[model samples]
Target: MPLSEYEQRVLEQMERQLSSDDPKLVNTFQGRASSGLRRWVLVGLGAVVGLTVLVVGAATSNPIVGVLGFIVMFVSAVLAFSPPRRSGPTGVVGPDGTVRRPGTAPKPSRNQSFVQRMEARWERRRDERGR
Candidate 1:
């Protein structure tokens, strides 16, 4: 099934409005971060250094030295494999302190209850069948 001209026009209008309202927000979604490769390379290097330290320390025979080496290796492996930590203003809490992911409109979401979504889906299905 394809969208009718009217539906396509409506979608285009909506997109235009959204772009106009928050261009920055739209750009963030469109843009891809390119620095992820650098992060991975750094992590790999750290892991190699950590492994070397662990092996040298283990060979020392002293318990403390061995433990330190193990700790370094563990830390390096963890840093290398763990998912990159994301930091940012994900959402600003109101004075009342409710956590909301950024770009989410609370009021619209609140108004769009489960029942409303079901009803909308039902309507769409009915319309498609009628078409």
Candidate 2:
């Protein structure tokens, strides 16, 4: 069923408020970082691997093999410390609270508090059926 004019206006106002409050929330939401202990442990492991590779490569007789080993070790170290990429909605949320993906219409603002919407729906249905 179509929304009444009042419902539509209320939704629009809620959308406007949410957009003004949090613009960053419109962008991709990044998850929290890993725990400090886990992060440090990974860093230590990377360091150890890097050092071992460097030492073994340097001790080797062949210069070419040593260079290759160094490159591999360097790449591994870089990958280990690299930050993870954000993986949430990259779309901007319009006036609505919904995240608007590219090429899609702005989502309808269903921003009424849950209780409010439910109560309104119940009232509307009751009135429609002459209850």
Candidate 3:
């Protein structure tokens, strides 16, 4: 079923708020897959170079060259498989364009175990939902 008018308005409002909050996140979600493809292309080139060096080293009698080639291959493989890191702060932006840092939740007591903290959080969520 289609959303009612009120629901549509709420969704539009949310979208506006989200765009205002962290535009980079919105852009990331909207971005094309070209960047990932470009990274893979670079990785492929590196791997090919590394493989060539490895072959050349093998043909010659250089152990150091072979080790260097292996290291290059390992680094290329890691870059190919690792996820890209995002730079910059993603803090909330106010209407006047001032960036407001997000507030962190209070940490649980130091004495509490991980499981106990998780359970307490779960209970709080459940209680909130009940109301």
Question: What TM-score, over all chains together, does every model reach?
Answer: 0.47, 0.35, 0.51
| Clashing residue pairs for model 1 | none
Provide the clash count, candidate 1.
0
lDDT of each: 0.73, 0.67, 0.81
* Ten contiguous residues minimizing lDDT sum, candidate 3: 98-107
In candidate 1, what are the lDDT values of residues 1-131, reduced to their tens digit?
Answer: 58999999999999999999999887776653655787777767776776777677767766776677677667767877778766567786744567788866344346688999778667767986896
Question: How many angstroms is residue 81 displaced in model 1 relative to the true structure, after the best TM-score fit?
Answer: 3.1
Clashing pairs in 3: none
Better of 1 and 2 by TM-score: 1
Better of 1 and 3 by TM-score: 3
Question: Alpha-carbon error at 123 in model 1, in Å?
Answer: 20
> How well is each residue in 17-100 modelled by candidate 3, as lDDT tens digits?
999999988888767557788889999989988888887888897988887888889899999889976445667664456666
True lDDT of residue 104, candidate 3: 44
lDDT for predicted candidate 1 compared with the true structure: 0.73
Q: Given candidate 3, what's the lDDT at residue 119?
A: 97
